[model samples]
Target: MKLASRIFFAYLLVSVICFSYPVSRFVRDVRMFFLESVEDALADHATLLANTVGTQMEANRFNAEDLYLAFDKTYSRPLAAQIYHFTKTGVDLRVYIADTSGKIIFDSQSRANIGADYSKWRDVYRTLDGKYGTRSTRKNPNDSTSSVLYVAAPILVHGKTAGVLTVAKPTTSINAFMEKEKPRILKLWYVSTGLAILLSFLVSLWLTHPIKRLTRYANDVRDGKRAGLPPMGRSELRDMGLALENMREALEGKKYVEQYVHTLTHEIKSPLSAIRGAAELLDEQMPAEKRSRFLSNIRTEANRIQDLVDRMLKLSELEAQKTLQNVEEVQLNSLINSVLESKGPILSCKGLRVTCEMDRDVVVQGDPFLLHQAISNIIQNSIDFSHCGGTIGISARIDEGMLLLGVEDEGPGIPDYCRDKVFDRFFSQPRPDTGKKSTGLGLNFVREVAVLHGGGIRLENLCGKGLHAVMTLPM
Candidate 1:
């Protein structure tokens, strides 16, 4: 995966882990706090009902009918237990009244539970003994939901305790409410978690996309392709890209100016010498024929210098051009043939035989004029180095997505010591026949052309023979 994606996902995972525990704890606390509020409501209702029953028994008006009336009234409300009314739901709420002798007087919900002297049952027993009493349950016989709460108070007559009135209500509603709430709470958690995950995924993709673009742009720069950055909002990443681009332009500009000055001087030196020699001859008062010829030679050399300067400047300009809007795919074979046709007379005059072996329809995309000059320079160099009546061979092919263009000759090869410096600006080798002559900027210009096209060039001695110049370009 990409670096940006890796970082984003890592951050998402850490954030989720860090936040999840707190959210879970808060939900649990809220549930417990709410349940406690409901529990408190249930407890309060039980206390009020027990106190009302105890008051009636103290006035001696609490007979069996009074007890039944009390139950029916209590049963009308939530968590209430009126023994006679509970038969509709087939549930039982036990009520026991005990006399001062600890004798049971009334048991409504369960007949067997009455008159057995529940003076021993905790709620009745404790009230009879002049202590507070509350909810109690026997082990459930039929269901886990059978737990009950009991509230009891002392009955009095003539300012003395007579018996106990106990009220019981089953704790069924609270348990049922809890069951219903479980799924609802889980549904809420599910929705919240899904939204969290979705938001995380989108944010992760957005944050990382620009960084991925930056990595690819860096690779293009390393591969010597046209590389540029889009404006991204992130300050640090944008600064890094701008800095790299500035450094590359600064280095290229420094090297280009230095090379331009050296090649210009080298190119003009020959013409200057020719013009100076011609002027000296004109001073000697020579024959009209030779005088006119010398002057003509000066003009020809001046034109040669001018052509070299123009071609070199064009190559340099192409090197720095950010956009290749004029570029297109052209057949390499046809282009090479055109350059060969242009050099035909020169090769013929040198008594050189040209051998060509290029695949048909070998194509490359580039600026046509620049590509033409690069190939022309290499072929011309081969021709210049070949012996009279010797052979200059040109060939091209594709290897692993790269187009390989080569020129070879069967003349004396360049010495190994000078081979490394052959393509440096203004570093020329001596002409084989004419001693020290020939401009040195040709190979340097060819190298620049290769770089502009995201390609490369190298010169090496052909095996057991003359010079071999190779240019490799991406197809």
Candidate 2:
């Protein structure tokens, strides 16, 4: 998974864990509040009815006929209450009375419960003991909808408790409301969680975006491509990028200077020794031809030293470049023709034949100057190794959206043991004809150019022949 996604999910998980208990508690508290309101209303009804019955009993007017008549009378009522997403219509209330002796005196809804000993019931038992009384009972053990709530109050005669009046209500309606609210609350939680996750995802992306840019910049530097620090927003991340850039500049500068000093010192030693020896030999009295040969050797060694220094400087400049300064569409055929033209004199001197085979439309996207230099180096190597009157083959073709340039020469190929080291700095194979080695910066410089242009170079022995060099670059 991406870092952004991991961060988002981690944050979301924590948020959900933190909010879950609180949200659940809040919903539970709300439901309890509504149920408490229903219980309070029921309690009030019981108290009021008990007092009226007590007053009638005190005046000797309380009787079973009045109780029956009061409960049996038809009363039409209309109710339109919208409780959340549900509606309410009619009302149903149950009432029962019991004597102080625990015998049932009246039952409004069911005669089966009348004439039964009600003293053991919580509502009547507690009210008789002069305490607030309430109970819940299920009419059927297996049926949840059969649950009912009862609240009772004391009936007094001459300030003495005589009986208990109980008001009861079934919990079916309340359960219906709760059932509807369950899914609604769940839906609300789901929506809240989804929105929270989405917000976290966006926040994660915003926070990590700068890090991603910095990572890309680091990769470019590692690949030796010319790239600049990406713009990180005004945050600590921006400060970090700046610090890295400064560090890279300091370290690369120091390291580059140190490497150049070491390599230049090492390569100049042999040429300097040769020149010194030739100069010392020239001091002796010798034949004119012999003295003149020593002078030529001294001059040749000095010139070789100069060439080595120049090549080193050029390669250093190429290596230091992080990216190409000039990028253009380069026609492969044209570049090849230019290089061949430049090398025509050498080819003529060696009596070698050159063959060019190329697609007229073959093109690549790169620094044309760098491409030309790289191709020229390869051709020069081939020319140095080619036998007199042998053929040098140059070709360019398109392969899988890339341009492939090949140079082949009929000369002794690289030995198996040293093929891998051919592109190493200051490592060169001797020329086939002269048995002399040139400064070994050419192939290395070419390799650096190929990398800068997102291309590559490979040299290998051709089948039944000499060396073949191929350079591949993007089209």
Candidate 3:
């Protein structure tokens, strides 16, 4: 299972285990608790009745007939007492008087047992022996709910024990109350369990969110995309993330330096060879025109080497940076116009006409200097590739919350084999006019700048005979 699932299930299991036992015990003991309360009330009634009966006996006016009449009246009276959830319609109290000999005298519930021997019954037997007594007996042998609780007190006449008065109440009403409340108790348990589950799920997601972000960052880096360190709160994970970022930079910096050194050396070799050959020739005696031609060749090769080194330095600086600095809002139209003006002499010399299709209000957020350099590099590439007297197109527009800036040149479009490598460092095609490759860092630098601005760059072959470079930036 996934980490979140594991966490959620683990938390839920613990919560359930912690909650199950106490709830079960409470549910199991509730009936007995109710019975105890009922028993206490019954004891009070028995004692009071015993005293009243003892007074009657002392006056020689003790009468079972009076008790029978009073109990009958109580049972017959209409009662609609609503006790929380249970309703009481009539009294369920029963009283029986037993003589000192443990023989029943008055049976309020039924007269059939008026003279029955009750010496074996705990309540009657103990009360007659001058001890406090109570007992519970089930009426129906197979039904536990049919149990009745009995409490007895000694009847004393003038401080002499005379008889026993016992009060009884059936547990049917208490059971009914329990039965009515069982579902509500279970419903509360269910609600508590559901809330626990929801809390577990939320906690798992909250704990794993930072890990997911860090994983995405690692994947992006593995894919060679520019990705920044993800935000992780003040925890051990944040410390680990910073450590990982530092390690990645250390490793990438080493690899970057090695690769650049190899490519730079290889690129400069050809120009160095040309300069060496030209210098050797100039050292020999030669005609003025030949000497001048050799000198120009040497200057051209030296300039080529210088240009290659300059471009490489710029690309290395850009690659080393993980984020942009000097952020500001840049007006696209104004920037593009400046790039075009900087290349005005070159455009005039090449006899190229530039057409711009863009709104004046287009703007984006980024480092102005980096934006200018990236755009200038793209325009310069187009200038080098375009045929003399050909037209170049520049356009900018906002689409889907992105600024799409495109530059197109009416030159031979990129070859199919070279298409994918156009944006690769030190990968370039021969310019259509010069029949020579550039330093090959221009498009790559443009791509880096786009990524720093939270955007991307792509090159596409125009229909029939041209190349288009599109840079997309968040607007």
Q: Taking the tens digit of each residue's C-alpha lDDT, what string does model 3 give over 1-475?
A: 9998999999999887777777888887998799889999999999999999999899999989999999999989999999999999999999999998888999988999988999889998888777888999999989999999999999999999898999999998998998998998888889888988998999999999999999999998998778889889899999999999999999998998898889888888888999889888888899999999988988988898888888888888888777786899999899989999999999999999999999888878999999999999999999999999999999988899998999999989888888788888888888777788888888999999998888999989989999999999998
Order of candidate numbers by TM-score, starting with the best: 3, 2, 1
lDDT of 3 at 182: 90
Candidate 1 residue 96 C-alpha distance from true site, Å: 9.6
Q: Candidate 2, residues 381-466: lDDT per residue as tens digits?
A: 99999999999999888788877888999888989999889988888888878989999999999999988887888988989889
- What stretches of model 3 exceed 4 Å from their correct place? 54-61, 82-87, 100-102, 117-122, 125-132, 141-144, 156-163, 179-184, 287-289, 397-399
lDDT of 2 at 215: 98
List TM-scores for all candidates, in order. 0.65, 0.77, 0.90
Q: What lDDT does the true structure give each of the candidates?
A: 0.74, 0.87, 0.91
Instruction: Sort by lDDT, best first.
Output: 3, 2, 1
Best by TM-score: 3
CA lDDT for candidate 1? 0.74
What value of lDDT does candidate 2 attain over all alpha carbons? 0.87
Candidate 3: give the clashing pairs.
none
Among all windows of ten consecutive residues in candidate 3, which has the lowest summed lDDT? Answer: 15-24
